[model samples]
Target: MQFQHPELLYALFLLLIPIFIHLFQLRRFKQVDFTNVAFLKKVTIQTRKSSQLKKWITLLLRLLALACIIIAFAQPFTATKTALNTEKETVLYLDNSYSMQAKGSNGPLLNRSLQDLYNVQLPSEKISWFTNDVTRKNTSLEDFKSELLSVSPSQGQLALSEVLLKANQLFSNAEASDKRLILISDFQQNEAFPEIPDEVTVNAVQLQPVNTNNITIDTAYIASKNGNNMQLKVAVSGSGDVPASVPVSLYKGKTLLAKTAVDLSSEKKNTTVFDIETSGNLKGKLELTDPNLAYDNSLFFSINAPKKIKVLSINEVNSGFLQRLFGQEEFAYTQQTQSNLNYNEIPNQDFIVINGLKDIPASLAVALQSFSKQGGSVLVIPSEKANLSDYNNLLATLGMGRFTEKVSAEKQITQIVFDHPLYENVFEKRVVNFQYPTVNSYYQTNTNATDVLRYEDGNPFIFQKNNTYFLSAPINLENSNFQNSPLIVPTFYNMAQQSLAVPHLYYTIGQQNKFDIAVQLMEDEILKIKDSSSTFIPLQQTKANKVTVTTIEEPATAGTFEIVKDADFIASISYNYNRSESNLQYMDIENWEGANSSASISALFDTIMEANNINSFWKWFVIFALLFLLLELLVLKFFK
Candidate 1:
């Protein structure tokens, strides 16, 4: 026990006044004669004893009253481990991440946290408030409460290490002798706590949810597409040991496309495939019937509509096979010799095939480099009698390796990199002992590029670097049989198909914020993204022909959105909630031992007050002092 104001204890000397009065009153007594001797003697004995007892009682009451008053002014209290000091600071970290939306005893865990804050008895110290996305310092208790009313579950997730580091920085320059951090969170297992410093003490309050069994649509992607029919694969995951069977639905704007039941009994993670007929832009969602944790139950996705590809063949010696391969109904193919090539049409083409160009012009090399840098793909087919220096100059300008020399030895294409994106979903099964393309003579180049097709002698037959693809041998009638080979169709078709910018199927909220659009907006036109509920203009920056837009304020809900320019639909975008908050596991209380933590807010406040060492017992002491004085008054009034 200790006194907050010990100087007031000196007032205990006032008790001497009451003692002196009692001693002085004893001397004022005088002797008296009795009328009857026998009666007077008996009465004197009884009256003397009663008078002495009353005086002792009265004196003790007065002394007790005086002592209680002095002790009340001294303000005594019990001390804790930390000694009380003048200045103190408190930092409160309230987690508002999406994981706090889980149900608790009262309502949502976030609501329970708010109720706990309302019942907290704040000390007379500077208070700092921290949330996942917002931070305010030196706020009053009332102000903090008012701000908390407007806070909701946020998509941004803050790890425990980040919160601790911020708290340490906030208290680093504090002049207070005792600094404390109060953390209120669901303590999700996805977030790990870091080692805390001993200079500042931490008081953690973990809020546990009622239900931990949660099933969510982890992710969805296109498995395969054949003509108009596409096989969409969706991965589902859960948290607890309990098995569950949930219904999964796919929707396209208000129309239900398909519905199926998924059995999550044995596997924690299961991938289900759905076949659907799609036309134009495919915008939809994969939803599961789980209301407990609804944030991750639905995933939004969009697949862009197919567009016609424009292919331009710049040839010095025209090859009939090149035109027949690219001049299909889906492609707008045009061929021109190098002397008759128009530089003005370069930007409009998706792919440019330089076929057997003996000499590449300086101006054409610059245009090709600019075209490749702006997301255009280039396919180079070198001539057998090509000028090595001219080809090397063009290759050097385009950041590709130069052809060293021509080899006379014949080689066959024996290896193909089937795992490359260019060959993704191209074959149903691997073909073994198949016929290979043979080249009588080819260029022997030392290029550090991804070898998509290797020769029989381990030399590169076809290599790619960024948007540039190099074929070692030309498709001349006397030189090679690559044009007639089965690999010729997909190799050229996929090259032109991949040149156009394809919108991503879906983006995870808080992870992807930037997107590139292939649209070339006019001077007066501005791009805007909108959903059914809200619309906003994003931060746009133009690079070459493409425009990159970054979301300024991300949407609160996940769904498919449309990007429009002047009321014309440019493309579709989809967003889904981050899966980090779907896991409901948390840290146990036993793991948090010795961390100065409490499950109840009131108990934590009591501990902090004890640590302050200034618990005000003065009010209770004053009540006792007044009661004692009342007792003394009763004794003096009635006993006399």
Candidate 2:
């Protein structure tokens, strides 16, 4: 029992005034009323005695009425230990991973799970939903239905830890009557489970889908060891009690390269080895030939074409450093002694490194400028032996602007642009040790220069403009002490590959896009992705800061997409996927841990009522007040 408002008990103090008045009160009557004198004295004394008794009773009734009024104001309520009227809003967290496509009694595991949701007699009380892949909080039944309808089984695997983190965050601010979390998953026993938060009560729902007679090809790789040209082995395993033969196919783009079938048994795993000759655009898909196992039918994979990059280094013939660095087979390098070489006759090459070209010839400058503008890259390492004025003017023409007189290199520099693409992941930590071997004199650019490395005096040492890059030091191995440094290999490779050549696009199968293709950062302002008509669509990244575009078209198909940035193309992306959307089965509740757990939904309501004890306590006091009013009436009528 609790009082909703204990303060109302103060009304009992009013009863003291009534009692005092009744005890010490006096009344005056006319003398004629007792005219019977001596003869009527005895009879009058009896009546007076009755009148006094009635007065006392009336006063008592009035006091009781006052007490009742106070009690009523203090509103009393009962607190039941168990649920008297149990009603709960159970939040269902369903895991809709690709593995959920396993078959079950209710059809595919995922579909069965959804049907089970509809089966639960969730009261008129609203329901909230969540998914392992998506966040759903404070969601109504309709919203849940909508999300479920739109949910396609995802390809990316989610860690249990990440799922729990999202679930906790979603329910953090919920004000539901009684919150319950019901997780439905296959519960792949090998995976680690995350710790549940104390505030939330977790109920794990176990999936018992039909066991698959599956033989999946885990992976296939190619290798040639010690002049032995042999195809590598590919592993295959059964996902269930039964196993059968699975067919594998190798392809170059859409062309079939090879095909074979391997038998798999339930008792043991099997591996299939094959050898093939291929050139460009190779991909593979493995499929189970068994008819019963349709959900895990085919798995797709891609392998990149072998790369052959060539470089043309033009400089004086006596440059021993250039000769040594270019000796490696990793690059196909061609050396030209003439600085006036024509680029038109130059063969197809990935990069062009120009050395000792003090004043670039007018024709060569035009060719290099056009090449860079057309998405090719060039690294220009200047020399102290040539004309600085002509090169400085050339720098202005390339949009890098005029250069000031060169400054001597120091042992260490300040504010190295570690965040730049060339250096972002090149080093585990900051490179604190760097010695400048050649203090080559040169003019510094005043405008349009992206200073990659800066000295303590704030002078730019390494900078880039347009597609052309300018290194303050000679890249030739013998000319500088850079090759002796441990950071030389990775640094040079990363700069040439990443900083110079723009990346193709980034695409993740089965994951939603991070950035919308239409959106751009223009003129220092955030802009939305819009069509030519200026209609906007929301753009967001899936996980990385890189943009992901969610095309309304069939995203399961393979295709390439280009991203335009700052009038420069940074990366090219390709979408290659075949997302499966077959199964819809649910988990079994009987086998789940804490399945028989009992909890009263009304306990929370009791807690709220207890906090409002003052109000409830007054209600009981009020009922007493009403009873007192009735007693006062009886005393006045019947006693009179």
Candidate 3:
């Protein structure tokens, strides 16, 4: 309680004057003529005593009335805060990630949260609200009502620590304003809670699911190829309760191709394989019935005809091993001697090999530089008796290290970089005692590229930098036997394979996904991706023979989409929502430091309103003064 007019409380001092008058009366009773002194003495004693009692009662009533009126004039009041003049800003972060689809008391957790939001009376006239993918600033309830209704599960989830930074962006730049942050989410266990700023009060509302059991189709992929048919493998996983078996279905467009069941009675994770016999493109989807989360219940994928990578080799001393490795069925192999090679065919290949060239011409070196810049890959195997000037010129122009002096030594290839992308999924285990190939005599070069294979003495046997690869020694059967080793197939195969990255079963949304389309387009032409609902042009670049498309956040919806060049359907691709949300575990909201936790949205808003209310006591004081005056009059007129 506080006083509004504290200076007016000086009137309380005047009540002391009434107290002085009650304590001592200054008037002496006038002397009257006395008659019958003996009889009047007894009556005088009784009358004097009664009159003194009445005077004391009247004095007490008047003092009480005066004190009440003085307090009423002071105008006291009670409030939650000391100063109520500061401006208030509120920012609400609502998490609409896929995990919100879990079931709660009423319905889905997201739907229940929506209803809770609708019931809240705004603490202020306006506020800012944001989700994973959208933001509305300083908007009234009526203004953001539509946006809230349209909020769906999203793949772009922000970590709990990131939410604080995102919400702070919407706050006004007033230094004296009171800031409030309201975070609403399921609070998944993987994210860390951030510390709250002292200037801003944080309120967290965590929604819990009644049942945590959820069965999800985790992923789908082509596990193995069976002749013309492929063995499609689907992995399913669950949390909490375990069912005996879950039926899985495979779909090509809308037609059902095959069905299988994954027995989950004994394991939390299981797999089911389907032998698909289709030979052409398949707009495929894998589906299962899961009562918990609908987002991870279905997986979308695609199977398209193989696109062969083009390989060109310009030879000075031709070796027949290149033709056997780049089989006709998979790679379009073309071999041309330097004397007969046409420069027109340079830009049309994906991977080019300068095979054991004794000397490189200036024209061929210039052509290789242009090709490398346009997304082509090159491998240089230096000859024993080569022109140092011409070979160094080509290497320098391609942003690679130039060869200096030749060192004649017998060395063995003893190291392999199994962690490189070229060697991904190639080795089941690291082999240390395998047969190491040796070179009889080789040239020593100075280069700062990643070593694909190293010698026993730590010199680079084969090094690569970006798209340009170099072999430090010649492999002409007379110099080295590296071509006969088991490492040769995967080493060269993956080098070319990575040059044109093939599209996977599905790409996660909100990530950097890039792939190539093997189609030649005219200048100024473009490519777009579309499904049944919408179409969008991804960030793309046209190389000499293919288009490299990169997507970061486009194709927002999860489904099968086709890459279209003008009117032609180039290939099919797919996108899926992230599966991290399928795990039903939740964070411990009670342990969050420096934050006030609420059970629901409506309760949090009610608390805010109550804190800012000011209860004034001036009116109640006025009523008290009037009642005291009535009591004083009654005591004076009726008590006697």
Candidate 4:
């Protein structure tokens, strides 16, 4: 037992006032003669003894009542521990990721958690709470109740370690107080459960969904494109027991373009294909009806009008191969000799190839360096029977390694860097034991760059610097047969494709996505990605002919947006939420050792209430005081 106001206990000494009054002689009684001497004396003695006994009983009752009253005012209570003396700080970690859209007993899991947080009673008035993208410190339940009522699912998901770290940072380090972190989440099975700290008491409330079945549109890609038709393939996947087939629809701005059903009866993963018009801009949306998570049900995408890449070749040899590869439909191929080359046309081209030049003019080297700085890509093919001194000087000027001397030994181009971004979608599988291309006579260079293709002896057959690609030997028919090999198509085609880096079918949100738009922006002008009524200006860099746009977390909602420069619409691009949370799998936090886990948030509040174990005795003390006073009144009225 402990007293709330223990100093009031000193008032107990005032009980001595009643004792002094009872023991001291304050009044004198008159002596009287009895009519019968012996009988009178005996009766008087019995009366005096009865009077003394009644006085002693009344005095004891009065003292008991006064002590009870004093103790009641002192506010005594019994507790199991001294927890009341320490201040408590609570930090709530509420998980509102897209995975919480799973259904629980009431409704969606996230909605149920929000309702519980709004209704559950807490011991402290001010608590710190954080969600995936929202945080508030020392806030009242009433103050955040409206915010909780309007909570929505987010695209961000923090791992357990990140949540713990954020929670610990919210606590104050200057004060010595009891810190507790209440983690309310669905506990998705995406990350590991990190160890809890000793100073903080962690109580986890894991919400369980009614079922784990979910179907998601994993991704979409351009399978193939013909004359006027494009084939789009979408990959669908499911968790738990799925249905036989799901209906997938293609819409262009709310107008249905095509409809198809994916067969999921035989396998958990399957693809469905649709063919649409190949030309023009397509603001496309692929949708499927799902009862589980809705974020991944509809995927937005765009297919902008095709922009031909500008390819230029400064050649001294026959240019038939370059013309054949860079067709008139896809590339604007321009061939110019050394004397006829126009330096002003260099800024407008996307890629430049210097092929078999006998001499590198000082003015040409300076022009290529300036073009490379303005985001133009270059590929240098050295010339046989060439001016080695001028070529080495050009290489040195461009920061490419100098060519030492020519080697006559034949070398096979055997290695390919399939992982490089230049070959990103080129190879379906790594090929081995194929007829490797060979170079008869090649120049050996001391270049320090990432080798894209290596010789049999680990020498660089083809290497790439920042924006320049180098072939160690010339690929003319007289010197090498690499131009006739099967690798020539994808190698030359992908290099041009990656040079411009046009947008994909769609990009996932909350990721670093970079692409180029060929539209040139005026000075002091910017590009905006517009979604509905909101517009976001992304991080951009302007080059000579195009603007490079990079987006991470803009236009936060997933949809197809328009890239607008001032008022004119340049093109359409798409963003979608990450499908990582599409699979409705949960972590088993209930069986975690040394954790205070609960499913009901209200129950956790009750547990906190019980943990204190403070049974107040002040009211009981008042009742005891009343009972003692009643006894004193009875003794005074009936003892005589």
Candidate 5:
């Protein structure tokens, strides 16, 4: 037993007041001598004795009542016998990952775990709650209750170590009384569980049944058959002691393509692979037939075949090296004479690499400028035999003008910007080494380009401007020794494929956000706004680069909303990205003692009760005191 407010014991001193009052004598009772002398003596003795007895009875009753009240105010309590006990401020760490949504003994294991938490009854306990995703390091039972009510299943993986570390910090100042941690989860073997703290007593409540079985899709890849083929890898897993066969099926556009059965070892996972030919447009689903764990049993995938890119080049004498660069599948290249330039007939490919356009006609120059403005990439290489004015005009259209500095004969190519995307993964480190031989003075350009492959010269050898980046230094095998190095092929291949291909590919296939729509900003604020109102209402942050708004029940649809706001807009409240409410994975309590781990709900509840125990003791003390006083009075009445 523990007394929360032991200082209240001093209130027993009030009993002294009654004792003093009882001790003080009233005027010596002078018995009237009206009665006979013998009767007078008896009357005197009886009166004195009876009066003394009454005073003693009253003092005893008052003191008993006072003592009971003081003891009650002291707030005494005893600890209940539990498998694990804690007197520290505890935080319950619950897992809310997608995998927790898997079914167990009582339907969804997560739901059953939550029900258990809600049913926990410890009036004298304090509790703080946290999930694998959103955690509150410093929180009270009251605050935890609010968050618990709002907890929803998150789609991300659970980080058990983090929750454990957090739990350790919560009770650092606590004195011992069996500080406890209880984990209530499915206890999946794949989930991480670290060692628990020696000082903290830990227990586990496995939510999963003894023999639950399941099969899941492990991975899916698109492999090229004609262009690209797709491969689907699946694994069957279970908790059963006996081996079982699981059926796996593949579907393409509502049509069943293949079905196969895979045998899984007892308490083990087995993998099976399936291949499909590239149809250029394929949307399909993979299904695994398992009695349990249905969420990961089915997988969806989509594949888009590659399309050919066409380009027109005007290289010097059609160099064999440059011809081979565009010789890959899905690339069609055409070379024309320098005099007969046809811009209208140029195909809409990724880019048009113009080797030397010195004597190009003004009409041709106008056509090239218009092509680039319309989202086309053009690589202009200046040669000693070409016109300069036309090239400068092209540069002017791209927010840059021609160079004013003359190339010095002593100038040499210097540092190269290896960080650029064009050079990324193009060559292995120290695999190939080559140096540029004697180079005739290359023309200088004022174009704001990214100097990717630079020369020893102070000026930029190769640079990029606008949306298009250029590799300016002459790749002519005669001028530079790059051809001798093994990196030449891969370097040119990656640059040609990645540089111009990025813009076109991203614009066509990437997720695009449009700003042209006329979005009505019904009002400037969103906190008190109604759903029926027409407006592009601002929302709070959901993820790294996303925002959302959600409507609740009682007159609205309960769903999430993806919101996009202008950069200038600002607000207070934020949004939540966690969309799934089905997941409720329970963290392992056994190893849940660290700066990151969370204390169990039971532990937190115990702490709160301990604090409230003080007040409860005081209230009980007053009641007991009153009862004792009444008992004393009854005793006196019956004896008298």
Candidate 6:
């Protein structure tokens, strides 16, 4: 035990004053006559004993009261070795992520947390404050309090382990004897906690929100396109009980396009489809009316206007079938024989079809390989009796394996890789017994390529390598029956459409933000992406025939954005918030109680105080002193 003001303990000598007064106050009696001697003797003996006992008891109470008062003034307390003898360093971590927007007792969870910090009486020590996006070190608690009011929640998230590690790093070189790290957060379960080191002590304060139920528009996509009307599919997901009715709205820019209400069942996910009119470069958002979490309630997306697909076919024979397949209005199809093959036009086409080519020239093979490398898709259909060496040379240049001798046996394509993007939404149902394409004679090749179509004998009928696809036999009336099969239309169309590299509906934040477009740009041309309020040039690099644009800075909010080359509008892109913050589940503090080192903020504070063995007992001592003085007063006034 110790005293805060040890010098005041010298007041204990004042107790001697009461003792001396009691000794000096002893009465010197004068003789007096009594009425009856026997009666006087008995009364004197009883009164003397009782009077002496009462006087001694009263003196003892006075001395006890004086000692108690002196001890209270001295500020007595107990000290432990772990108590802070020198200046202490404290680090406080406040979570300001989007998840903190949930409502708590006072207001928003983050706002409540800020108020709690304001109400706390900080110790006289150097303090540091940390959040997900900012860190202020070695600031006074008053300054930190002022800064805390101005802080708002951010989209960025910080893990518990990250906070601890950062605090440890900040205090690693500090000279203070006692160091403490206090974290206050909702403790969302999205990020995993790392093992904290034993050298640093941490105090975790979890803020629990009232409502955890949330409904979010997880994603949206273009289901189908029919002229000016496009069908979009939106996925809605929720936690907790399903809402009875969820109102969904679609917006094109600021204009409301469509609105609908969906009846949700017990299922966690529900897909709703809406058909809306769309024109060129549509920037839109799909919003769900959910009050629990406003951040994920709306999903931003973009849709590019339909554009003509350019296709070029090079053939040795005058095959009318090649022209008929790509001759639709949506395609700008051009056909040229091998004699009139133009190397310059290869870069301008979205897809190049090499149909029944007798031999591939060295210059033409090099140009085609360059086309494939620059994001252009190629479909190679070799002639049955074509020059093997020429085809092999072309294949070798493209890093595709060489074609060996042709197989003269007839084979049927019995299996199709339906899961491939080429066959997406093509057939309503899987055809178990359908007419299969037959190849009379096919080239044998040894290559590490994905087989999209396989023969009954487990041989590859069609194989693809990156953007380049190879067919074992030509699509001719004499060589095979593929031209008459139903698979020919979708197989040729999806290849052309996919080669254009359609813009995605949306992109998630905090990821590699790069988009590949089939449009070519000049050397001095600059690509800029903009929304309704802002515009900036993005980092762009042009490849052989396509341009790649990378977003240098992340947008402040999720919305639809447009890409342009100087004054010409290129495409539309959408961005959405990462869904990781939507999960409100948290790690229970009870789980950490079992661990000797881990504890809650309140528990940790109590432990720190206990370990320091430093507590002011002066309040209790003062109460005791006051009670003793009251007892002494009552005895002097009425006890006699």
What TM-score does prediction 3 earn?
0.89
Candidate 1 lDDT over 258-298, as tens digits, reads: 89877778777788889978778878888887757778878
In the range 1-640, model 2's lDDT, one tens digit per residue, is 6565778778778778877887777875445445668867777678788988898888878877777666667666665432232444456667777677676666777777776555444433455666644666666767676577776565544555666666656554644444456667775443444556655556565666666444454545554422223475666666455445667675544567667777765444677776755443334554445444353455454333333345667775355555565555445667775546656544344467777676666666676666665445577777655466766666766788666665444333344687776677577887666664333243454656887766456666567875577766444444445445544455455544532222222244565544222223434433233222322333433211223345433244344433345445433345444332222223333444433221221332243344333323554566677878888887788775
TM-score of each: 0.71, 0.50, 0.89, 0.84, 0.57, 0.67
Q: How badly does each model clash, as a count of residue pairs?
A: 0, 56, 0, 0, 45, 0
lDDT of 2 at 418: 78
Collision count of model 1: 0
Candidate 1: which stretches are off by over 4 Å?
A: 1-78, 81-83, 124-126, 175-177, 241-244, 309-340, 351-358, 372-499, 543-545, 592-594, 616-640
In the range 1-640, model 3's lDDT, one tens digit per residue, is 7887888889888988977987787876544557887677767777778878877777776777777777778888777662364688889988899889898988998888987887778777888999999888999878877667888878877887788888778887787888899988999888677787777789899999988999998888788786578888889998999688899998888989888889988878899999888678888899999888899988999877888888998887756888888875668888888889989999989999999888898999899889988888898888888888988898788767878877787889998878887789999998888999999877677888888889988888888887889888899888888889999999998888877876887899889999988888898899999988889999998888888899998888889999999889999999998889889888888898988998788888888888877777877877877777788788778875
Superposed Cα deviation of residue 275, candidate 1 (Å): 3.0
lDDT per residue as tens, model 6, 288-366 = 7777678898888887865677899998866687688888867889988888877789988888999888888898888
lDDT on C-alpha atoms for all candidate structures: 0.81, 0.55, 0.85, 0.87, 0.54, 0.79
Question: Which sequence of candidate numbers ranks them by TM-score, best first?
Answer: 3, 4, 1, 6, 5, 2
TM-score, candidate number 4? 0.84
lDDT of 1: 0.81
Among all windows of 10 consecutive residues in model 5, the one with the lowest summed lDDT is 502-511
The root-mean-square deviation over C-alpha atoms between each candidate and the true structure, in angstroms, is 7.2, 11.2, 3.4, 4.3, 11.2, 8.6
Q: Which 10 successive residues of model 4 have the least lDDT summed?
A: 78-87
